[model samples]
Every structure is written in structure tokens, then in C-alpha cells.
Target: MEPSPLGSVDKALLTLDALGRAGADGTSLAALSTEVGANKSTLHRTLAALRHRGYAEQSADGTYRLGPAVLGLASAFLAEENLPALLRPALDALSAEVDELVHLGVLAGQEVVYLEKVEPRRAVRVWSAVGRRRPAATTALGRALLAAGPLSAGPLSAGPDGGTPETEAALAAYTAPGTTTDRLRAAVDEARRTGVATETEENEPGIACAAVAVLRAGRPLAAVSITAPVERMTGPARDARISALRELLPTVLPAGLAVPPAP
Candidate 1:
């Protein structure tokens, strides 16, 4: 019972993606046609339509690139999405108390999409940004989100690997001291049990974080985390951060976004 794909729309989006990858210099029609696998004429028509809508712009040299219209669309989307605005004040407050970076992220398939980032005054250079994505298994935010439920209907109706050799290789590739599949499984289980997730230098070396989901009726809508240098996150200080997150969740989350009582 699969639905039919919208071929033309797909092609148009692929063309835009190609242009984005091409960077500021833009791409010529010949290159775009080759990348999108379309005839030059059809691609021309598509590009013309996009240009008319202000989604694409042509440079003087006959190359095309993404236009300011894309920014407009993105702005509209973010405003309508509202998650960032909704969480900002709470995240800001949390960052102030902890004197560390606080980020809010949502689960997107196998990754977590960062929506907002609040950096303390003495923040480290974080590798993430607003709209960036990272693997769910490799972060406390991802583990916390997964603790609520899967993004789609599948296994773990009740909930959501550490490593074999294959997994070890994959984990090694992810980062040094990266998460193994088995370790990831263990983290998910722990989050389910405790309603919090923690990680040390998994994504970026020297960074550690503790996170918890903001749930809506037992499903995770998003997650929030406090991140700091590994040395700063330890003993009573780390415990205090976890305690603060648990205490703030009820007050920070709006009415509709309720965290179901722990089982």
C-alpha cells in the first residue's frame, strides 16, 4: 500500500539540493542537469519556475544558486514550528544556572535535530548549531528522546547494542571512545528506567552532557541537555544538574506538553 511518488516535485527538490551543495559560486545548467539526471530543457523549465518563486537566483555568469527566498521560507517555517521559541526562556535559565551550554533537540529518524542552543559565557566551541543533526545513539539528548518512544511505529512499543566487531568498527568510526551499539542499547534502557541520560565525550572529546526528554503524553516531543567540559561534570555537581533538570521539567514544559508520571 505504498503511495506514488511526486516525481517532478522530487526532481525540483533534488535540483535545489544540488545547488546548495555547490556553495556560493553556484552551478551551471550543464552541471545541475548532470547531477539531477534531467534533460537540459526540463531542468531549465524547473529552474525557471524556482526562480520565479524566488527559491533560486541566477548569477551574471549563467550559474544559479539558492536565493534569499530560501531564508524567508526557513524563517517562516521556524516561526510556525515554534519549538525553539517555546523552549528558549527555560533553556536560557538552565544555562545560566549551570554555566554551561544547553541545547534543545528533537528526534528525527536515526538522528536528533538541534532546534536551540544556549551557550554560557565561557562556552567551549560546540560542533553543533541550530538545525544541525547528529546521531541519536551518540548523544545524551538522543538517548533521552529514544527513551520515550521510536519516531515511527516499530519495535519497542513498550520503549525503545553495545558492540560486536562490526559495531566496534562503526563506533570507532563515529569518534574516539565513541558509543558501541551495545553501549547505546544499555543507555536507552537506563534512560527508560531513570528518565535521564548521560554521556561523556561521546560526540566531542572533552564534552559531557546530561539530558532528559520533554514528553507529551508519554511520547518525547523534544529533549534538553546541559553540556560542559568533562572535568566540570562530576560528583555532586553532575548530580545537581540532573536534579535541576528533573525539577524544571514540569514548570518549563507548556500545558499540552506534559511529561507523564514515571511508571
Candidate 2:
């Protein structure tokens, strides 16, 4: 007989809770099974599915960790949860001013997962999502969040969307065609200094974007970004977009949601 699904597979999804507790270090099968209150065999299959599609990974030491793929799903879920819902109207207003696509994203491992998107009227607009994923080291939205994270946070790590690049090439290189890893590092530093980040055709040729991070209780919760066509992205105009995003930062982050967990 086919097995039943777990706990309606919604807000109470045990895997998310497990991953949250495990943090970046990941957890062993035995440990996660205990945390989720599920049998080892059942959790193994669930984890296998998560692993098969890149939502989870088994480290060399044999522990299971959240994979890059899960970021897309989690961001989508979180944005719809409560906080982002309140910010949607404001994000929509920003989209109106930009006359291009706008998106809200959050850093997940080495990338930003699109949490919300305000599409332009045109059929030729950049087609991504409220759930699509982009590399943190390569995309403006990701950089914005990374730059705004606590000073103790480390640089972006490797993820699955692109694959397992070697340490040298991944750290010292730029996966985006026209950029370098050093340049990305510099951009992150700049964003930290100025409170925002921007990109010109780095993610996609002829596409330009500006982003500002939303911080809550000293942690970066998300970033708001404006995307414009290359032709219209004048230098000062780009700066203006970044500036506008900064204005919304305080409103986007709530008073005490930063920790996402109780202390």
C-alpha cells in the first residue's frame, strides 16, 4: 500500500523544523528522525526525495543538510507566511515606479530565492518567480542580503543550481559571465557600506537590478529589488533605485522577527 503523507505537508512540515534546528551544520539521519518524531525508514525516504531533487544533500561525513533547492521553496513559503504579505503592497508600489519587474528575495545558502515578483505589463519581461532561485554571489538581491547580514557572517558558499565548483574557481571566480568573484566581493563590501547593492547585466545580459536589504534585529531578513531594462538603466537612475529600496527597508522588516527562532 502507498504510504500516507506527513502532517498535511504544510506549515508543520517536520523537515523544515529539523533543518532549522540543525542549522548549516546539517544533521544525521538518526538525529533528525528523533527530532521529527518519525521512524528512521520513513524519514529516510522523505530525505531521499529531498536529496534526489537537490533539496537536501549528504555531506562527505554522511550527515544530511538543507540543499540549495529547498531555499526556493522555503522563501516562497515564508514570503507568503505573514511578514512579506504585509509588505506586498509596498513592493507593488515600487514596481509601479520602476515600470519593470520587481522582486523580494532572501539569501538561502549561496543564493537568493525569489519570494515575490511584481511583473511588468509586457509579455517580454524577465520571467522568473516568487519561487525561482539565483546565485547569491552572482545576483544583486542575494548580494544585498549577504552584505546586510551580521558582520560575523561568512561569504557565500557553493550551491546546487550551478553545481559543485572547485574551491579555487568558486571563490576566486564569478559564475556570472561578465563578473569576477573579486568584483562580487567588492560589491558585497560596497553594499555593506552604502546599505544596498546593484548589478548591470550580470545575472542576464541586458538586465539591470538594484537591491536593498531588510534587516530585523541585526540579521538580514530579505531584500527588495528593482529590475530594469539595460537601455533605461542610466548610472544615476540605478543609484536612485537603490536609494528607493533603502527607504523601504525599515518597513519591510518587522520589530522582532529577525531570529526566526525563540531565544
- Which candidate number maximizes TM-score? 1
Worst 10 residues of 1 by lDDT: 151-160
Off by over 4 Å in 1: 1-80, 151-178, 259-263
lDDT of 2 by residue, 1-263 (tens): 44456453531257766876687899998998888887888788888877788877899998988889877865675453554685677677777765668888877777678878878675434668678887777787877776666322444433454324453354453335456765776777667667667787777778888777665556677778888887667777765665556554344444433312211
| C-alpha lDDT score of every prediction, in listed order | 0.77, 0.68
Error of 1 at 54 (Å): 36
Number of clashing residue pairs, candidate 2: 1
Checking candidate 2 for backbone clashes, the offending pairs are 111-136
lDDT of 2 at 8: 34
Clashes of each: 6, 1
